[model samples]
Target chain A: MSLLEVRDLNTFFRTKHGIVKAVNGVSYTVEAGKTLGIVGESGSGKTVSAMSILQLLDTNGFIESGSIKFDGRELTTLTRREMYEIRGNDISVIFQEPMTSLNPVFTVERQVSEPFMVHQGLSKREAALRVLDMLRDVRIPNPEVVTKQYPHQLSGGMRQRVMIAMALACRPRILIADEPSTALDVTIQAQILKLMNDLQEEKGTSIMFITHDLGVVCQMADDVAVMYCGQVVEMAPARTIFGKPQFSHPYTEGLLFSIPRLDTPSDVRLEAIPGAVPHPLKLPDGCKFAPRCKYATERCKVEEPELVEVQPGQGVRCFYPDLKERRKDG
Target chain B: MGKYVLKRLVYIVIVFFVISFLMYALYNLIPTDPARAQLEPMRQQLKPEEYIRMYKQLRKEMGLDDHLVIRYARWMGIIKGLKGKFDGLLQGNFGYSQTFKKPVVQQISEPMKNTIFINIFATIAALGITLPLGVYCAVHKGKKFDTTVQTMSILGYSLPIFIISLIFMYFFVVRWGIFPLMGSKTPNATYEPGSWEAFVDKVYHIALPVIVMTFASLGGMTRYVRSSMIEALGTDYIRTARAKGLREKVVIYSHAWRNALLPIITSILAWFLGIFGGSVIIENTFSLNGMGKLYWTGLNTLDFELVLAIQMFYTVVSLIGSLLIDLSYGIVDPRVRVNK
Candidate 1:
């Protein structure tokens, strides 16, 4: 069995306007010790779907219908106490902005060491001793000094490292990192990504990586799930999605082509997918991406498509999954 | 941090002297004569020449015969004591209260105890009610309980304190007859002063005032705590805390409360230091002998020595409270640097 299986999850939030379908029927799984990157633009429910798996939805947001099975145990029915145990111990989450993730009033030692104390039942002193090792595990320099400092005293990159250390302290089976490196400079981002990858390998932890950066996905993701309007449009092996492929979602194609390559002609403009994401409250009737798809048809505009496998282990939510044929016709 | 406190202490000392001198000078400008106010009731019994002699002797003895600058200097013990010993504020001689015909310190002791006693109960009740209720409201924000508390508090907040005080008195005292209507003690009821019986009787007598004081102060404090807790609870760290799988209690109390407390410490400290001078309105309404009412009486009687003593107490309390508030900001929030 896959280590964690999230099946047909529907999460919604009750706001002043109406009930928002933040995560609509999103389904994926994380295999043991492999990285599954969920990629999408902002407000695309990449974070919300991940938040759904852990039942970490905000007070307004909740999993309306879903089944999350971890280690052959159904998660949705667990009591709050049981869920608490599974949270830092079995599945952990690191948020996007490390700058705001660590509590300001608390020292690094107190925050990072808390998981050990909570999950493993270690004493505070014992937890403190383990914190240095956890900090070093994330490759932070001066682990001893860093543990003594407050979150504000450290640099942004250093704080992200501390967050990773805190997340991985209990050696959790799965780590859901929601754009963990997005707030840092490119160099620091690269460093943080490398650290997360290294820690994942050392601990043999499954990772559900969420980010809008496709470049980072190419480097880190074993498999990629492209999400738009709260549903995954295309999910396949990184090789199948990034490399020339026989079948892919048109939305996925648009995302891949938007980046300017080194060999692209200097005179040519970078190809960007036209139009913004439709207001979620007023989503189009057919395929959610139909409004922006260059090759959208009358059928594509009238009938919603289901995620169907056209190639081995590749799923695309489009009537015409054949990207080469669609390109030729255009 | 040490340097910051030392600097504050120096400023406090300078301000204290300036304030005391200004107070003495202002009292000198007042038209009332302390000796005449004191001896007026007894003047009919004395011969006219004898009365004249007695009045002059009393003025000299009271140090009212000196020039304003000399009197102030003597009062502060800035020069020398009148009788080779320092008999001014510095030497713990608070002069006298002509109205009460007693030493100012002795006269003030009962009022001070009463004020502190009432305030102690009020403050404790305020802190106890606001902190937990506010936190719960924030946690269950937008829930039925939160909305109910919010609406009720807003209603309570709009009504004037006197209205609340009178209403409480009417209901608890007049209608129910459950509590005493006024006074800090039961009239003619005998109990050993410091015994358990006396303490219970005193609390029973003061319950209405304490409740009124607490109810009057409760609305603003609760709302303040609620908003502060809500802000703290909404921060990214709180999300991180929840994601840590820590129990919800730990998440709210330990992580969120610690940050929420930074803003709250200022108000709590203010309330604590405020116990020295009780609420004048509440004290008067309840007929309790608190410092605020005492100070008001002193003002009317132009009891300069008594007023000056109270003013000095306030100045000292306020200065110490300021220093603590600044230092505590650093203690609660690591971002605030105390020394620099």
Candidate 2:
């Protein structure tokens, strides 16, 4: 069994206007000792779906219906205390914008060491020593000096490393990193990605990596799940998804084609997926991507397609995910 | 930090002098003679010339006949004192209060004690309630407890303090008779001073006013605390704290509350220093002999010495309050903490 298996998860937020279907029937898995990257645009429920795994949604948000089984235990059925125990011990998370993710009032040692104190029942001094060890593992030089400093005192890259140190302190089995490198500059981003990958390897930690950066997914993800309007429209091995598969979801094709390539002619314009993700409250009734799909049929608008296994290990949620003139009309 | 405090202290002195000088000049210009009020009976008793001579001598003796600048300088102890001694304000001379018929410093004691007495309890009660209540409301924001408290606080906030005072007095003092209608203490209660009984008696007499004071001031602050906490809870750090799997209590109080407390320091300190300012409406409503009531009477009767002393006291307090507030930022949040 996968380390963390989230099945048919539907998370919704209760707003004054109506219920916002932030994550609707999203299902994916993070295998043991491997990285599963969930990629999407902003508001595609990437963060919300990750948040639901820990039941850490905002006050208004709730798991409408979901089965999150972690290590053969049903997380959706666990009591809050049980969930709390599982949170830092079995599953930990690192967020984007490390500058804001860390508590400014506390030193790096305090923030990084808190998981140890809370979960492992270690004394603050004991946690302090562990904090130094954890900080060093994240490759922060001068760990002692960095630990004593506040979050604001550190540079962005250093702060991101501190957040990683904090999340990995408890040696959690699965780490959910939400846009972890998006806020850093390109060089720092690459460094953080490498550090996360290295830490995962050393700790044998399964990772649920969520980001909109396809390049990042290609580098770090063993398998990739492309989400649109809360559902995973395509899931395949990283190489299959990035290296031009024979059969690919149109949305995935749109996402790949939209990347402004350096080898393309300078005068050639960039491609964009036509139309936006529909407002969550007013989503399309059928295949959600149908409105933007060039090959969308009248039937496609009336009937939603199931996420079907198109090949041995790949899944696509479209009537015509094939690109080689598989259409009957042709 | 030391340098900042020292700079503020110097500014305090300069600002205090300028404010006090203006007050003295303004009070003198009011054309109300505190001595003339004292000597009114003598006006009808003596010959006009004799009464005039006595009044002139009395004015000169009171330092009221001096030029405004000279009188201010002498009063502030920039020169040899009014009574041919260096007994100006700088040398611990607050002169005397015609209103209370005692030295200004001596008469100030009872009112100061009474005001601080009520305020300390009221402030403690408010904070004890507000800190937890605000954080709770923020955590459970938009829920029943939060919404209910929010509506009630709005009602409390909108109502003028005097009306609240009247409502409390009517219920507690007039209707229930659970507390005295007025005064800092029983006029002739024979509990020995500093004894437990005396303390209890003081507390009993001031209970209604304290309750009224707390109620009247509770809304603005609880709301302030709630909103500040809400903002704090919205910060990314709070989400990180919750994601740490800490218990709800630890997350709310330790992490979120610590962030919330930074902005709240100023309001709470302002509320604390306002203890000295006292509640004029509440004190007057209950006929309590607190600083607020004394200040009102001092101004109405033109008790120049009393007014000047209280004004100077507030100036120093507010100046010190601002300095303390600025210094506190560094303590609460390291981002604002300056190495120097």
Candidate closest to the true structure, highest DockQ: 2
Q: Which run of 10 residues does model 1 chain B get worst, by summed lDDT?
A: B270-279
Give each model a TM-score: 0.89, 0.92
Worst 10 residues of 2 chain B by lDDT: B272-281
Q: Give the interface RMSD of candidate 1.
A: 0.7
Once model 2 is optimally superposed onto the true structure by TM-score, how far is the C-alpha of residue A189 displaced, in angstroms?
Answer: 1.1
* DockQ per candidate: 0.66, 0.68
Rate residue A327 of model 2 by lDDT.
44
Top candidate on lDDT is 1
Give the number of the best model, judged by TM-score.
2
TM accuracy, model 1: 0.89
Model 1: native contacts recovered, as a fraction: 0.76
Task: Show where candidate 2 strays beyond 4 Å.
Answer: A326-330, B1-11, B33-69, B190-196, B273-278
Give per-residue CA lDDT, model 1, range B202-274, as digits (tens).
8898898888778767777788899999999999999898888999999989999999999888887766664
lDDT tens digits by residue: candidate 2, B170-247: 898889989888876788888889999988888898888788777766787889999999898888988888788888
User: Which CAPRI level is candidate 2?
Assistant: medium
lDDT per residue as tens, model 2, A8-66: 99999999989999998998988999999999999999999999989998888999998
